[model samples]
Target: MPLFRAEHGGAKARPRRRRTRNMEWVGSCGKTDENGHVLSLTRLCLLSLANNMKDMWAKDYADNYLDHYSFRYIMGPFTLLPGELVEELTWLLCTRKQMSRAALHLMLVPQLRGLSLESCPSLVTATLCAHIAARCRGLRSLDLSGGQQLPSKVLCETLCCLPALRSLSLAGTPCDRGVIKAIAQRCPLLRHLDISRCHLLSPAALLPLGAPLPPLPLISLLALDIGFGEQEGDPAAAAAYLLLSLPGLERVAMEGLGQACCLIQQRQFNRSDGFTDREGVPRLVELWRDWRHRQGTDTCRTMREAAAREEEEEERTLSDGFGSDSEEEARRDGGPNCSQNQTEDRKRGGDLSDDGCLVLQLKDVKGISCDFLDSLSLACPNISSISVHVDDFENTRGESQGSLLATGLQAWSAQLRSLSMYHPGPLVNLLPALQVACSSLVSLTLEGVKIGPHTPLLEVIKACPGLRDLLISAEPPTTPWEAEDEEDQRAEQNLPRLANLCSLTLNFSYEHSQMKPVMSCMSLEKVLKCLLAGSPLLEKLSLVSLPCPLNGILQEVLDLLHLHQYFFADSTNSPLMPLGRVQRVNLLRTDVTMMTVRSLMQRSKRLKYVDVSYCWRISQVEWMHCERSTEVQVVWL
Candidate 1:
């Protein structure tokens, strides 16, 4: 009976034995053995099982496989010792793989230094928080971006427990002032924090005024992103308050459109173009500039007296036992805390130059008056990049505002390299500023600015000699151009200013065009030729919202006259051949055909990425059937 049983079970027994033999074993000697492997608890097997585990969703197959009883025993003798457990688990599950709360719980080993739980929906739960607190006690960096399911209270509580945490990201989390205050009090060692999109957070939570409550423990925070959120308090006041409090803050990003809406709603403030009672906001900005500048200037006797008053107030707080009593005296005499002593020394020496921040990105300032811009530019002299939205000259009904905006820009003339502006109205008055002020400007973006037939885009390009990147988006001219006169005008127009341009984007809105494809295509080719002639080093060209379809007629016209070769050819054999180095062409939101795209791809050897997105003529079937021309990546989504 035993012999018969062995014969029947041989089929399964043989494979099981072979599988065990194939498993690589790491014994106590720290050497791998395949053959002579003992099934003792001391030995571990580096399991290399199924290859199909990659197809599974959420849970990483390797992590799941490692979680198996036999595999866990092999890789780690994860013993519960008395001292802290150290594990280098960074990037252990960072491959766009989602891990469940249970799986995360299993992986949470004590003494984890870094952990990134980005995009994990189940990351913030009672059980998970308990696991993190108990196991990940020594974690230094924690990233919880896109975890919207995480409750603010739970998040604050979890973060408060991790005292050693240095970097934290609560981006997209529904956190408020309470959470911010908790972080300030609990996470004193935090060096970097991202609270972007936390709409409920009040600015006062970060910089409480009236009397400094023993000074915030978040003095170590170097970089902050408080961008894109609806403020519960006045943002301008909050910004000033923050600058006065956090002296060590180096980089700040406060780009949001909410403030603009509020400003536009207040029509009473729009009295006159001239600086008057109507210009109270700009005056406030100027006052803020003075107040901030006075923080470190000792030469000014009046400012010194104010500083003396503040110091005395702090001393009074110490006498009331609210401050660090012994440390307060030591700080006053300049004993320990070298950073604090240096701050005090700078205060006494009237040195404000070192107190300026490095980068300040402020967006959606269209509702903000030019005076505010002026004060910002003068106040933050050390800033290298400034992004602000200014009221258009057309909407404001005067050139003075545009001139004022330009004048404000001159404050950072030497330091400024990149300038981005969104002008909802006409930009005619603002052109003079670009022409003379921003000489060191390397990149310029002008969006939503109307350009009539008389608009001198070429002149704007000419103003910045060092300008390498230029983006201009505007509605197409309402008055249709006379086809007969356009050719004559093209012959006289010169674009010598675009010689240094490397990237050019000319986006037009088709909402106002009255011309047919035949006329529009000709006009497009003419404009392209003109721009290409001027930009010899141009590498990226995006002609978004084309007025006509790139179909058979356009292809035939180019083919018959051999214009395709001149426009797309690598060599400068033809006089009309543009010597420009264009590598990518984006024709998104147009009516481009497969044949036209194929021809363009075949001719331009340097063209690598061709985006014909939303082009209805190029069907999905046709795109799939089309041959890959010149290794070009044609995107037709």
Candidate 2:
């Protein structure tokens, strides 16, 4: 364990002594003179020296004793010494361990602003709370999470005394409604409150214990995180009460209150009948019945049919070795022509002028409508990136007409540089809309979404020319065998030129267990070489949990540059791998060997970090072969 050093920045703690009339009063504290200014200095010294510093001192005196006379005579001479010349004092040791009543009294000071006594089970007595409330009057933040449980009265008194607190964290503590009411009544300036694991407190106990008076204003909280307890009782009511109490709150994070969040937003946005129900119960049952009457059990059948038609059209255009009319129509609608317009776009330098970004993470997408995005765009016009994460993508949908693709295209497309959607529901209109609108996109991450599952992933790559980072954590389509004597036509197709690509992460980890093993159908060797052909500036690559032999993966990548030279012999001047700037490679949970790792390191001089963890067959001795290479750090399982 590391030793705790209370000295700030390796400097010894000095007894601050000012040269004034107060100095003499502080210095002459223990001297037993005829003026009665001293109280038996020799006897006090003998008593202090002989005793083991037991808890005999008054709590008030012990907590504020540093401002008194005893410590003045003990360490006042060290105040004249320079910082570098001061010797280390072994008697004064301070740590975060549980503080006895005497210890806490001695440590309390007016200058202290922050205190973290987390998980100190020994310091849970009511006396400690009373001492802190009396002495540490200037504290602004306190973290007593996971500490010893306190009685409701002591907890109430402790919180009520700290009216100047700006932040208070009491997670995993025992408290009742009375203590919470005391805090609400006293700490009117409190901005953040976290009562996450207070299991004894229910929604009924959290109903804004104090109302705003004429002179005193209501507390304007910036954030409140209250969830994850055994007795949440009625989360919707609690959330509603918090919102009604703190109307100006900016963020509210609740772990087990997703349904409540959705309900709150739905009521706030869709106020047709003012969302009035008899017992505050929602109209979800009525809405479900209405939806079932409108649409049959096959809810997603329309979406599937639309996607199948689009896929057949895309495949027909690819098979004929020509572009479709829809592709030209998309270009006319503002799509960037990857092969022809990239040179001019490169000259212009793709950089977003705005720096602001908006992030939204949702557990349910039932209440998110296109009007919501429109309102957000109007409110925050300079938002440069919009990231969306949905918990259950396959079933998430809006109860409105405009689809998710329409929102992406019509709202802030010219300013967006990064678009990340995890577990998307459907993509029949997404690619076409993106190609027509978000041309300046620099980073795209689509995890657990099927893109070109019937066509090819190369088409999706070619649609965006300015992409710098691409992470596709989804499986592609298996090449279809047309005839017994023929092969899949897509096996030999070339990839689009993405000259600005820098980082790529393709994780097919779910395929090993979810789908049948069919590595031969992917034609991965040809596909990989095609994908890496124009991305010469690539720096980081992660092929995590791929169920394939990793023996020739690096060799195939290294040979791609030479193949590019052969295929495009017209130019013939581009350098080998052009940038050759690959610095990190993560092949975690793959079948990679040490020999393959060494070969990759030998090829890329700038390779710095490689994670080949969980390749159990590789020997420890083989790990030593690359240990001497200073540029690379081999991560092991």
Best by lDDT: 1
Q: Which residue pairs of candidate 1 clash?
A: 44-74, 298-350
Give the candidate number with the greatest TM-score. 1
lDDT of 1 by residue, 19-109 (tens): 1222223335444332223443222211110111133321353455433422211112222211122122223343324345434444565
Candidate 1 overall lDDT versus native = 0.53
CA displacement after TM-score superposition, residue 20 of candidate 1 (Å): 36
Instruction: Assess each prediction's global lDDT (C-alpha) against the native.
Output: 0.53, 0.52
lDDT of 2 by residue, 409-512 (tens): 46666766766655543344345545644477888877666433343455567677889998878654344322112254454454566788889887764433
Clashes of each: 2, 2
Model 1 residue 505 lDDT score: 90
Q: Candidate 1: misplaced stretches above 4 Å?
A: 1-53, 56-146, 161-169, 189-192, 208-233, 255-369, 393-399, 482-494, 497-504, 508-527, 530-541, 548-585, 599-610, 627-634
